[model samples]
Target chain A: MTQRPSDTQPQGEGNGSKVNRRGFLKTVAATAGVSCLPILQTDANAFSLDAFLQKHFYEMSKEELERVIERLENEYKKTYNKKEFRVGVDPPLAGVRFAYALNLAKCIGCRRCAKACVKENNQHRGSEERGDQIEYIRVLEMKKGSLDLEKSNHYYDHPVPDKDSYYMPVQCHHCNAAPCTKVCPVEATWQEADGIVVVDYNWCIGCRYCEAACPYWARRFNFSKPRIPDEEVNTNTHYLGNRPREKGVMEKCTFCIQRTRKGLNPACLEICPTGSRKFGNILDPQSEIRYIIENKRVFILKEELGTDPSFYYFFD
Target chain B: MGPALYFLVSAGLVFASGPGRGEVKTVERRSVLEDQHGYYPCSDCHADQETNPKPRFLQEEHDSPLEWEDEAGNTHLVEFGEKLAIGDLLGHGGQTGNRRRNLVKVGARLDVAQYMEEQGLSESDSVYVLTHGGANLWCLDCHNADDRDYLRKLNGEKLSFDDSEYLCGQCHGPIFIDWEHGVHGRTNGYWNRELDQKDVTRRLLCIQCHIPHAPRFRGVVPEAKPVPRLDPVSEPTAESHGHERHRGEYDRLGPHPWVETASTGHAEEPAHDGEKH
Candidate 1:
């Protein structure tokens, strides 16, 4: 095998001076910086990337976190070209209220909605590093001839609707009986009060228990730094939706909690062309979504598992 | 030369392929470049393009001759209390069956051109059929929609709205950008578990916020330009006031950076043409 050029090797034609002098210097400086630092450098008092993220998401008070929020706000505006932005720190959540619903009949195997969701949620479209499988929604195109529960499709080819086809969009159920939550050795993943399951990405260890524990292949682990471009990024990132995730953490959809809980509709709901999905407060009958669930023929996926999912699907 | 060439193209009669399998030998059918399938013929609506050679011929053949030239070299025909340039109808300026109190609207469009040519008159100045209206919209701009139907012209031809998005995209680049980003209009699914399956429908970017009837070119984006990063709305717009009824000024409202470029709850119109929910 041909040997690669050595950073310090002299190969200037017949002149034997090092051609890659600059590369050699950079490598040397990097080595020196790494060697000089202790294995665990104490920040005078004591703080680390993991330890700080371990704090409750809402632990930072207004006075303590004001500077941080402002900094992120400015960063977002500068990057997105938005002006006069209002970014609120999470005051607190009564509980992580998560809900989802899919319409089986109207989902016509058109994955235009899937593409929109991918863009909105910042799921790396290409192969993700081990811990980073970000696609929260998968459209299952079932054959019109076979409606078999066991034999339905999870794969879709281009130029859809071969006579008879139905689309079923899948995402994390945020199970009330969350298997992944049970197996977290580090207490990193927890169920919020409002029915949403959340993982403190910073607190997660590289343990794969959560991955194994879940029946619905929902959770994904990030093995490397996320590779989303700065421009395509949705800068109004919540912990769940648009933010660039870190290495070695598990992530999934948050129902666009960043937008939904604040009285805004989820991005997918906002852009559906054929009106095949629905959302609203389950508690409020007057809510458009509630009226549908109460009045329509509603059913959940994998009902036997008894996850008691907030999501429900229905037909007329 | 431009005018002369146009005049030649107008007068030169040629048979051409038209909508569907049939042959289209008229200028009217040939003018529309895109929507050949939906081409409405000239004589089908009015007389044949051959019948109207120019203002003089149109007047003599149709039994009327006039010109609508004024001191500024063009007559100010009025309609909707606005001056409209009818230069698209060149050389055929005259009094028409369309008029008010025997006087022209300051900027009339269709009628005066026909009337002036019928009168067989000329002005010291050349005609400026019309300029950009107060809305600053050129006649050829939004009117290029592929499905337009033209009534009468000697050339017997029509045009398309190919360059239209550029005109609309000018003020609404944000909407256009958002559109390109797959965020502006409806494409897929959204969940409001509260809504019925049929309730969620296509999202309308242009006709949604802007009333569809006039759909006057508004901001750069379609009416519903998504400011994703959450710049607070200082005050509610007429379109948004119903759902986002809290009428107060926002301190700062904007989208996040890195990309260019919301809710409803209320008794929406029972006949909302947009995608539901």
Candidate 2:
């Protein structure tokens, strides 16, 4: 709203117009309100008007994105009490289409990758008092002779490679034809140029449509405000990847977007003691993923559903 | 040609045709001996020791003595060679089997003259009979007898311990191909070399995962399992309880004191609005 000083002015400035007390008060009030506008825009929680009115990641201009990043960095630094916190927006590299491969014969069902995922991303550490546990990778122990997922056990706690069973770890596949993206009412989640399906936490409307639509059950809804220990928080976060998520929003694996964009492998891949996980740009003919897809007996989960996931599982 | 010469020629041929045939080498490998081997640079212990070239059961340096219980309920210290024979008889599949395979495969080439003499057996005895070819591998088949420091290839070419993969590839041809293609072994660091020049990709050497004597990977106790997702009832059962004791009180609480104070410092200010309006 423009200042009402002009409307209050009875005459021109040089003609001695500001004689009335009421008009003076009005002008002073208007100027004071305008001066306090910025203070009122932000609250005690650091939930700023800028963040509330922030545009979609794709729609934001370079300058706007920079300002948003700065605001997020400040917010996260304050929340986590970290001296070095960064919110990176590194985009997809040229001629790179990311793909992942897992050697079924090699995975030992150690769940080290799952633990590493929780630490790398700032997922909620669950407890009896506050029950919001979230992990990206779920290693399923399947029977030796069956491909039936329903028969697989997720809670086997013993030395792995049970003589009669095999382990199959399932996670967000980042499908080429992602069903989660299609079901997002607010278009908050979508597949990126590099074949990673990312969710804009700010844009999600907490509708849970995408969670229901996902065939792999890859999507996770934050039932309560995510509770991450300040010390355990991963300060090196990406805007759309492992950044702290809010209550009621959806989040999933972005293949460690913060790390991968800078040429580092995903946290799970690095922590796999079995060396079963392999990831690389499928577009690169010399890449490991390409070699696997070309030579190994690779297969995608639920291929008949036609999700066409970039992730592949192969036997030795 | 003799069996040794034929084996050498075939091993050389395989090395020539193995992976990394034409590709620009990008995978940086760590030195296997320095990183994994506890007792390396054999010269450290064998510098003044006499070299015994005979093919016989190792009774001293290489022997890992095992405790054995005889039929009379008496315990005895059994050497690795005797243990290997016992394990082979019992059809065991772990360390014992691995050692037996390695020793038997190597012993196939050497004359085993000392072994035959100790057992009081002739060349015609089935127990002491030696088979030729790739199956009969011995310690000197890989290790150089003249020089204790270097390993010798099948073709009698000396190789440093760092180049042990070349020797391993002679028999494990297919696995070596997979390892070179970056599919079988563990590789850490940058997946995309073009993006970051400083973070060089390091692939784990074969010896890093498998012991030279016992190549089989023994079963490991895995990390803890995930918390089961079930409805919370009035009473919490053992099945429903998570690893709560492992976590600290700070993790279960609301916003931490420092964060709470930093974000909500203005909340402490008195409410003057009640009288102002």
Candidate 3:
């Protein structure tokens, strides 16, 4: 990426030459150091000093937060050509801890839930030849009478609910002991009080450590800017959820933070035709998730690792 | 033209019809179904038919049938009528004792008329009839023949399109039971029905997804198909690994098949070969 002219200021010849010499040497040294590493550039070439020095989510003042939101809203409006686009930062609801469960027996492997997730979350739609887009949900088609993950196939194109097979859709477990957050060298990702693990796109350095840490492979790293058609852009966005991401950042499902915080169900939950997916406040004993956990023989993937995933899968 | 002159001209034209040509203006009666389903005039079938009060077949009478005998040695058969009312239709799950249960409500018909009047619409503008894969069945099989209303309950209750499960339950009792328990169809509301009623309106109806005539969930287009998993970075050396046939081998084993190979230290390649947009 080339440095923008806005990063420098005009100066007198004598002093400017001396400063230029020093900057040239500094650039040479920095370039040499970067060439040996695989670190990704987290920002676009346009260098805004204020954005570069923006504070973390917890450390931002009220005024600064407002300024950030306005800036992002303007940028998105210009980029998507949607003047009415809004970016919201709705805080998590009090006394709500979300948990998810999937009934394997009922899931027909239709993949409608996965399709709805992409649209609701504003995920990039990849082309037929190139599967560059990120999908938060993956419905794995497994042979019937088997609980093994290795035998599952996610790319099967045949009609679903095969006579001899079943399906299991998986996404971020949002585990209590989230290995993704722990492995983040920078505190760009963290679990909210409501148990949703969220990524701060601007703060993330795009190291991809979290991707490697997750056993379920839930985390998706943006190798390039995500492409969403202007008309297809989901205007409803959350700071920690479906807001458009930058060129390089790590993101994963946050249980539709933009919707759930407002007492709405996640897109996938609403799209399941078989009533297989269940989501609710785990703390509320009267919640459906609570009933499933208590009554159904529920289990989590990679349980031996003790990740304590909020997501559970049961055969019932 | 000036506004007054335009109004005068239009009003003069309206009054200019000569008394000698005193034919009254009449609307051209165009059947709304003509454009969509072709014209069908009632006269096509009713032409030259004599008005008879009794059904022809019934009036023929059964051979040697006992009749005109009452409890006091006199009996009679009630007369069958020629003109059929809307209530005469029977539907699925057998008969509701009263014929009125099968009848379309007069209010509903009037509502349609009112709507058409408001919108400047005309008669028989739509058809709800569907062909279920060329099955030879009449509309009266599952709906009232005259008004197309559905009857699944015997207590004279009519079901809306949203109440498809109950309507379908007429013949599919087991499937209806499964749907009631949230096992057969989609459920979107808050799992804890006892809690907030926020999700009540959002619950999806069965007809919203499945076509009632052909209740099958269609597969999504290829563009929306689930992508394959990213290929694992490493695999066990075919020579070094043994006992590959064991049922629970991968589960109980220490080293997983997808573990990073000792040679490659976290290779972070793009999952797909597609060029970045």
Candidate 4:
């Protein structure tokens, strides 16, 4: 570990110790007060100074990114005792903008999608210290006649699809005019070419600005170190999605970038029993999402805000 | 790739060892009792009986107990016992058994006149109607069934279980049209056809999701409510909705914390003081 610079310095080696030491101490105090480097350094991880100074995802050079990825992989192996954990930086797919449409009539509120998301994203399981598990998707049970966000009940434990109710699962909408990205002071988060808004976990300064800016309450802040069991950790993680996040960073859904970039379905879509959830490249006119958008009365959550969210919902 | 190639080579080696001698020498013949045989070339089983025998119902020795299904009473009930009298069998109103139960029995040959008289149905009206419950049409309506328990399609064409869609489409025209567009039933293949060829074979048939006898989807057990992130340090709330982990004061609906930071005069330093690991 690199020792943090302190106010004290050793006596000069070549004599005239008092004069030289006084000058050195004065200069150090002057720099410390103006720079705040000492205060920021204290916030850095004690184990590795290099990790603390690592650049954000976009700012890093190719070689630097590779170094970071290698370090992360090694760190995962040591922490989890699993040599097979792989962390890949998959580039965004070209000529493809992902979109999702969920049918309100077909969803039965089984929450199988939510369950699969927790497992796929490797979210923290509930512990004695943390009673609730972290789930990316929230299925809101709303009354049949209205679509009131405030009146919706996500904690409804009753036998679902309760004759008069309908379920709407909400997550990160990956808005085109994302307010979260605009509010991020450090440019730690940004929208990719494929319409996915991703976060550079390491670079996020725990500012929680993105959390406040998101209209759907999509972003989540890690107030404590995320504790995941060794067996439950999903090794097929991407640089932008489902990566092991540290305490104080913000994390939200990324449309399962690791799987989607490889032409695989998101875990939630694959697990849905009713086939209510639909996901596909929005660029392709023949895609199911496009068909639904054209044929069905598709609507976004807060259309008035003009966020241009990729996620859509329609009734039968 | 190497392992797959090796396995293919090994499989070829095993087959190349030659077929068993006995299997090759044996004569290939369809079984007499096979369902598709349907008493074909009848002499094998009925060699003694003359070609033109007395009417089926006139023969006393071939008499079988008629079983009535009490469709109105309880369709799920299964009752099998006692011979029904001719009068009782012909009586329409007093028949206590479900009409949908045993439309066609294994060994019993229904007398058309008696069935019509018992159910008060005329020759112009068919006994079997098609729906989710029992089809009004009997086994003989769609199948040429014999006493030996063999069945064949009425037109002598083979019926495919996989292509039952056409058979069901005979009556359900609108629903079948909806199914063709992947609207009604579960579709199990790639939704994006530009990437992968449209494989209709992988799509689920109407029968796969809905049983013909009972077309309703079975109720599934709801997954446990998401244990929201409760304040681990605080006491548990008795109210179900109250346990929601309070997202700090600066969430979606709340104002951005820049104002408070300016007021507190600690804008230079990020305020992450209370976070615990």
Candidate 5:
């Protein structure tokens, strides 16, 4: 029966200050209110109060989501100096769970997918001044004989399929039991019914806890305001996917949720010259992913962690 | 009222019976022959001339190799002009001496193995090999001798250029099967079959990616490296992160040491014990 120091302290007498629960709560409320005052005041402009108080994606009604999309579209149009901007909110289709299979043998260490991802996702294009570049995919050039990730080079600059090396492009695996989602303090990130793990950009508090928790180095933080050029900004955006993210929010691969939800192949898959990247609905019996899993030498990145990633790497 | 009801029922039945679930609908694809610029419609060149179905070394348009020198003072050679289905040798048999001599010529380049061995270069040093089935095939083997435009199957069925997958599938059965299932090759457009309203889902034809004469994918300069992050995070030291978890895992889970054999779809045993776990 040890009394804690806080319980033993005389509330009104300590240091000539009367600090009780009520006082502490009042202080907290005032701080929160003051912090949110800017967002509250900027209702008419880009930072709308409604946007700040926007509910989680799943909780939002159809009408509410529509309104949010309209607001975002307007905001993006002004910010990116575009005539028209679309914010798609397509829900996951029935009996469809998206999965990706990359042919490791076919991947020639070409970063076409990475570049295409940046362009399609509206990520910050780093300049000399800003010094912040965000890429969703990292193609690791590993020696043919080794599986040591430490020995793998992320920044190999040469004509690829380099003598004794093989390329392995790693991205957000969108795990069934995602560590990133579990550690999300604000419940901003979660796995969709279609197995695509997404983050609500507006709801994220930039804690970076999810980033640290991710084993695949999937989560990327916007350390500064994303500096996308007006011309380069991708107008087609999704709320829980690749809508141009604000500063401090965590962003990763959403399986191109904006595109995938509409039954279109992801930008990376489309741009791959080598036909290395494969994507399909795993639930469907006729899907290429199922074929690869069944026939090819398929393996997940970190099977021991029990992440059960929808992404599979295979060899022909 | 009876006649009107009967007519409506008949119309509904007709619409319902248009295409059954199992009915095979031919996907309308752009003609591969028409897509080939400058060198399609083999009949254009062969129609007026007499057909010589002899297997001989190409001495004309198809034989000219485009040669150039790079900034590094190294010579680079590229086979230019129309790629015929013909190989170095005409057919199998009666060319044993020639085959033994030309065996050193892997792909388009002659004496490559000898050159590599003399230079003490590894197999990877060579950029690419450009032969189809080790020059074992003749033009008439796949290409129809009767009709220059149509490809010939083993059963002598004439196939259009667009249906070259069927021709390729004759020899590369496993890969063809994988391609048909959308596993081996690139698939563009809609991933969902049901929602493919515009018929955007297009599996690339064999000839689209691979030249009939040289099927091996050539290595090329990759895209630019990602801009390095400004504030570099300290990497985890090798000692702290020992390879205990991945020590034996590489052998079992790393790229399998299976040799690709065309005859049987299954992977053959590992070439040597060094590659095995």
Candidate 6:
């Protein structure tokens, strides 16, 4: 094979054919400078299945997870020439803190937060009568007197208030005593060490038991194999978020744990033009979510139900 | 320079014959462009699509064509198809041929896995095996571009779809509709102004919607497709098919029953029950 400029070198486009497959492989190896493993397992140099089996987001040792992030950053640098792209293998902060506050006064029913949530959590896609793909947050418009969920249907043809109306967006509460997790037969759905509720798309049996068990009707089953045409499909997947799910398994709000744990604000918070939503580490007193819980009057839906949901609502 | 350069692009998708091989296989690739994105030759962007369609300077020279104006506006052409890449299209970046390539915009139909569940193909031995096997089917098969007449779409009356619209529409009609009508599609702008006119906003091309490096959504994480920035001025607009269709009311006046807060609270008030707007 002729000596050729590497793809990284940015030669004029036609000058690229000089490199062959073997040369390309060699270039990649030299660029990475990572040594090959001596054996499949047992050897100190080899990758062990143990690392894969126990690699939960919260359960990782600091050194181990940091190493993983380093490996990721290196790989990304090699691919896109971003010399310093670091990935988070574990949550930056900790404890089983529960905090979410929604200001009823601010929410306009634009559903931008819902769109952001669907993208952020990699929520499975579905269709609504609006003839648009939908998932997760369903912004319901309610009249002042009517508390009935059925009457407060979210479907809107025009913009804001038709008259004296208010919008309520609902999603998974990630309850501390989650009834859905308890009812899961295959153990596909479970609460994480950080108290975030999650459903493993690969493991879910799609039994819909979790859907039935939830009093809030939070869980939704995949009706069709999620046929997300490539663009809309979320690739930054967790076992719980974004990866395509099997049909029939129950799914609900994951509290945007994928984003929250990464020190990124929840998609809903970013997209809320009205700034109706707030998210932060519940354990930390400085977090807005915590401040709202302490300073303002807060209420959890069906607090008497004892599910101990992480979500809280505020009126003032 | 004429249509001779057309076949060169398709020829590149063909498997190469190394030193030991002789005859290049002659399976003409059908154009998926009209049925989908556009029947575009690869050389239009890539510098290497058809480097040598004919023998030039002792090597096989591809038939990539270049449009250059000579003295009296009479044009002279250069064809080097296989050797073409993205750079060659600097001035005439993409003026090769007439192949309307629209981004096949598809809205969330059934989550593929969800749809399979509705079909009862559980992860049992029989079902799982079929799924695994079915995944191997080449995307180009069902996404057949050969059918010239396959381009029929419900072009909603508003803004006529440009090349981007037609390309994605051929294989994905439903998504095309949503995109054109604002569900699957995207635009850029704030409270007001027309697009690409006074308050211009470029439409999210194919690349925008599907970011290759950071693909927002995809399954299995195969080599992700390149996505461009598709941040629209506003969300795709809703298709207003002259109603009296789904829920009657072509137009009317009353209290907007659509207002959730008003209707539900005052059940006694008939005016609140969507009888108004």
- Per-prediction DockQ: 0.03, 0.20, 0.08, 0.15, 0.24, 0.01
* Candidate 2 residue pairs in clash (backbone atoms < 3 Å): B105-B136, B105-B137, B106-B137, B106-B138, B107-B137, B108-B136
Best-first order by lDDT: 2, 5, 4, 3, 1, 6
Q: Candidate 4 residues A164-240, lDDT tens each?
A: 77889999999999999999999999999989999998889999999999999888877777878888889989989
Query: Scoring only the second chain, what is candidate 5's TM-score?
Result: 0.50
Off by over 4 Å in 6: A1-92, A96-98, A127-134, B1-277
lDDT values of the candidates? Answer: 0.49, 0.74, 0.63, 0.65, 0.74, 0.48
lDDT tens digits, residue span A215-304, model 3: 998998776578888888898899899988887889899899988776667899887766788877777654556667886788889999
CA lDDT for candidate 1:
0.49
1 or 6, which is superior by DockQ? 1
**Which residue pairs of candidate 5 clash?**
none
Candidate 1: segments with Cα more than 4 A from true spot: A1-54, A58-88, A91-98, A128-133, A145-150, B1-277
Which prediction has more favorable DockQ, 3 or 5? 5
Candidate 6 chain A minimal-lDDT segment of 10 residues: A43-52
lDDT by residue (B106-171, candidate 4, tens digit) is 113456565556667554442222223343433344332333222345465545443566666667
What lDDT tens digits, residue by residue, belong to model 2 across residues B129-234? 1222325555678788888889999899999988888888988898899988888888877787655577466787776666454455656777766654442323
A1-316: candidate 6 lDDT, tens digit per residue: 6656673574443776676778888999986664434233653223434333535444568886566555544543443334444343344233435456787755656777777776665454544422224366666667766666656644455656334667777888889999998988877788876677787654566788888898776777766655454455444544455444445556777666555554445667665644467665565433455556776678887788899988887766
Model 5 has a DockQ score of 0.24
Best-performing candidate as measured by DockQ: 5
lDDT for each residue of candidate 2 in A1-316, tens digit (9 for 90 to 100): 7869887757765788656778789989999999767757656254578867888889999999999889888777777765578888988876678899999989988899989999999997776554468888989888778898866777677777676778999999999999999988778999888899999988899999998999998888788878899878999999999988888899999999999988889999998987999998887666788889999999999999999999999999
- Displacement of the residue B124 alpha carbon in candidate 6, Å: 72
TM-score of chain B of each: 0.23, 0.48, 0.31, 0.32, 0.50, 0.23
RMSD per candidate (Å) reads 26.9, 17.2, 22.6, 16.4, 11.9, 31.3
